[model samples]
Target: MPLRPETARQVDALVADAQSAGHVPSLIIGVVRDGALAHLAAAGTQPLPDADLQYRIGSITKTMTAVLVMQERDAGRLALDDPLRRYLPEAAAAGPVTLRQLLGHAGGLQREPDGPWWERSEGVDLAALLAGFSVTKVAHPPHRVWHYSNLAYGLLGGALERVTGTPWAQLTQERILDPLGLHRTTYAATEPFARGYVLHPWHDTLREEPRTDSRAMAPAGQIWSTVTDLARWAAFLADPDPAVLNPTTVDEMCAPVILSDLDAWRGGYGLGIQLTRDGDRVHVGHGGSMPGYVATLAVHRPSRTGVVGFANSYGFRTGGIGPLGHQILTHVLDVEPVPTRPWQPAEAPPPADLAPLTGRWWWMGTSLDVSWDRATGELVGILRGDRVSRYAPEGPDRWRGVSGVENGEVLAVLRDEAGRPAALDVATFVFTRDPDSEP
Candidate 1:
């Protein structure tokens, strides 16, 4: 009743593959669907068969921190748009950086100031960490682009402490971990912590390393948790409990704020969350990576499916956990695979002879090349340099795609004073036509 028959087999195969490749000393995977946990599997050893321990969850800590901030906001203690200086005056002189900017990684702060603390220092007090930020310069104009910064969250942790008159770690436990009944999850410094491990480059050997304490950057990454505990966290993300954070606020946290096109794994970043669309359904969650551990938690809200995967070894790389988790969810839901075609705006008819609508349009910073089929008197919209779709006129300036995923999707064309197609607003994407484009 927990997992679909085939899904259990698929998970078994994945764990076996990881074991054979020595990618992970141990792994724990959990899947939840329709408000209930479907499966929880643990394989391998915590410390090579001698120690039974859980792994550090690296950057996944940020997601928990983000949730705490939202909880405070829900209680009317603070606002997301409040300037960092509003909470901590030390940041006032830096510039106009807001808590929203910090959460979305748009604060223009460096990824990690004072060098990599994971490799360098044991731990630093909040005051010492904030002191180093004085000389830290902005990398870009605020909110101009997406730049992952651990330090920004670190500063956010300080802001929370200043606002609440408590330490970041305590605030998280009181606000999130404790209320959620995440008994097995706690700060890395807690008792029964798992020793971190790194895989040697040359041979099939894993070396146990001292666990790095990120007290100063605790907001960025500093939490230890087991797979079982993460399963509950994933469930909360998929269908939030209003007592914690309102469902709408959770959705807003997972909504896209910036586009990440720098790599093959292109997606959007929300407030401490990542947004990736799998066909019509959007997956929301976040991934974590530290020196010796990698973890990913994602949820398909529409399907009420969530996956949490954790690895013990540091060098273990599985591309990204989000896609893998999504694949598992699809398999469970029996959903068809997502096509590689990029989403495009709907098409519209030309006002006169199908001439006025034949042009390029930009929608939400994405362009869709549109042309008129003179012979058929239809409109075609091409997306992502490929994937052709045809549209038939439905109304004055609205058209509906006849085939493909865009089929049945409506398009509304915007016109300037001259009555020419200047912009196109599709179901959700907005497109602005190229000026020089001719019909």
Candidate 2:
């Protein structure tokens, strides 16, 4: 469904305000719902003629690079826990930094190469970049802290090419971009692209920024995209195309692997994606900045609403691109609320075998409810402290925990000789109907 006229105006107003306040040369914003474009608006210092204009989406390219890595992992070509040294022995100096750590920016690699600024000057080839690797590249011990490293992603992109025998760009094009019909997103800027400009701090002047190809480091942030294509990509991240990536893998990409901010539980880093918490609302996406362009893509997963923002201002000190996207999304959610699905009875009642396990169990004098979910075909356990755990049937009279603290733990159902409920043994902890009863 299209956005209401009034709601659309409000969203446009937000974009216009951001452009004026941030001194952006050009700005474009789009919202997606149900995997379709809901609203799009643009503001520019010059009269805007086209909506398909591209902006360099900086590190946001890492998300796509990460997706390709996950795709390779899914195809059995590689594993997340595989050490970097396994693929490229040159990286042995970094020690046991796994693929997962590199993706999550916990690989302890330096943020950039020790050489002169690669983003400004044309970068060296992948082989030359890798040959210079030394233990000094290991900034912090592997997985000790979150260190944003463009070099790590560059290595990952090269590793992907080495493992697949296909260029990283081609792999991404075939596996992701083309599959999702994001033709507008490309490695180089196309016609009608916005000119990246650095907003002068003191004077009312603008300096054009060069679009340098980071060569091997291109995977870190290289693609040029428009809000239109990005809105589609955002939708893909939320509701993935199974042909490109498994929905489960996409979910893993959105889940936090390490904390980006230690003070507040506000931010974390996932495999390739970035996670943000705004009160109870959780957002998954990434932000990018090139010489003269800044871009952001954010999706409120629960609501299936997303916002994409692009501005042709190099590293502006205003409210930042992520927050702009967040504000637009929040405004859309507030004005155009997604109707909640009304509760309805299940087509069939709970299974007969699950009846005995339905009520309650006691463990260590605490009560836990073991309930069956017909929708998910799993047994859910609710502890007194409200820490809910989900378990799926593993075998006869046995269940395996699938999520929460009990994930991977086993729940063994003990039955009396007459086939009556007696006690449940979970990870050696016994739970019975009577708290005082012995195992």
Candidate 3:
């Protein structure tokens, strides 16, 4: 569905304000809902003739690289817990770093390679980059802390190459980009691409920044993408299609693996994805920055709503492209909020065995309610003023709590000698039909 006129205008004004206020050479913003573009707006002048101009997505590329790694895991090629030395035997510096640590930025590898600033200079090939690794690169012990490491991703790319017998870019293109129909998202800048620029701090002048290939470190941050394509990618992150990645794996990638901010959980690192919090809301996505380009993608997973934006100029220190993108999403949410659908009766009746289980029961004189969840086909148990758990059927008259405080505990319905319902025993905690009834 199309966005409301007022909402669209608000988004446009936000983008326009960001471009001028940030002194950005050019900027593009897009909002997506349920895998569809709801709004797209561009500000300032794009140097390219085509409207679909790609901007260097920087570390957002890491998210795609992480997806490739997960794909390998899903196909049984490797495991997340597998140590880096298992594949890249030469990476003795961080030999204990597992694939999970690398993905979640807990590998303790240095933030950059040993050579000159790789982003500003030519990048080395995989062989040369790996040759430069040393024990010093292991800034912290494996899994000690959350440290952003472009070098760690570079090593991961090498691992992917060894496992797939193909370049990381090729694997990503075939497995992720092509399958997701993100043709415009590429490792190299295609035609009609934005020319990155660095705005002067004092003077109102601009200088074009050099774009490096980033070669071996490309997996860390080298992809270029347009806002439209990124919006679709963000939508995919919110709602996996199963063709690119199974919904479960996608959820894993978005799960918080470590805290980026120790004081409070305002920021966190997922499997190759960045996590941010706004008030009580938590969002999943990634931010990118090359020399002169900056971009961000934020998705409200609950609503499957995403906002993506990119700018050509490398400006701002505190609230760069990230806040700009998040602001767009926040505004859209404020203007056009999503309403939760009201609960309704299910069409199918409860399973015959489960039918009698629904309703109020008493456990140790405390009231509990059992109800059937048709959505998941599990029996939900709510302990009054305590906890809630989902129970999955185990066998005849037996169920197992799959979640909550009673997780992994067994619940069995006991019957009298006449085969009539008598009592319930959940991990030895007896429950009766009547609160006043004795055990």
User: Which sections of candidate 1 miss by over 4 Å?
Assistant: 46-53, 189-193, 262-265, 317-323, 335-439
Q: Which run of 10 residues does model 1 get worst, by summed lDDT? A: 45-54
After aligning candidate 2 to the native by TM-score, how far in Å is the CA of 372 from where it should be?
3.3
- For model 3, residues 1-439, the per-residue Cα lDDT tens digits are 5689988898889877877787787888888987888878888874622337888899899989999999899999999999998999888767678999999999888899987999889899998998956788888987789999999899899999999999998988898888888889888899779999888788967889998898899999989988778888998899988988888898878888899998977999999989998887888999889988998999999888988888887865336778888887877777788867898988988977677878888965898788899988788888985689988888989999988788889989998898765777889988889888776
Best by TM-score: 3
For this target, which candidate reaches the highest lDDT against the unseen true structure?
2
Question: How many residue pairs clash in each candidate at the backbone level?
Answer: 5, 1, 0
- 267 Cα displacement, candidate 2 (Å): 2.5
Global local distance difference test of model 2:
0.87
Error of 2 at 411 (Å): 3.0
After superposition, candidate 3 runs with Cα above 4 Å error: 48-51, 342-344, 385-430, 437-439
Which scores higher on lDDT, 1 or 3? 3
For each candidate, what is the lDDT?
0.74, 0.87, 0.86
Tell me how far the alpha carbon of residue 110 in candidate 2 is from the true structure, in angstroms, after superposition.
Answer: 2.2
The collision pairs in model 1 are: 292-314, 362-431, 362-432, 363-430, 363-431
The digit string of per-residue lDDT tens for model 1 on 1-439 reads: 3775666878767655655565677766677776666776556765432122466777888898898888788889999989888887766655888889889888787788575454335778787776645635578778888888888888889888887888998988887888888887878645555555787777857787677777878888888787667777888888888878898788889877777655744578888887776666677888887777777787887667788777766655554444556676666666423224685664754556467666667654556888877557678999776877888889888899875568779878878898877777777576765444333
Which ranking of candidates, highest lDDT first?
Answer: 2, 3, 1
Pairs with backbone N, CA or C atoms under 3 Å apart (clashes), candidate 3:
none
lDDT of 1 at 163: 77
After the best TM-score superposition of candidate 3, give how far the Cα of residue 35 lies from its true spot, in angstroms.
1.9
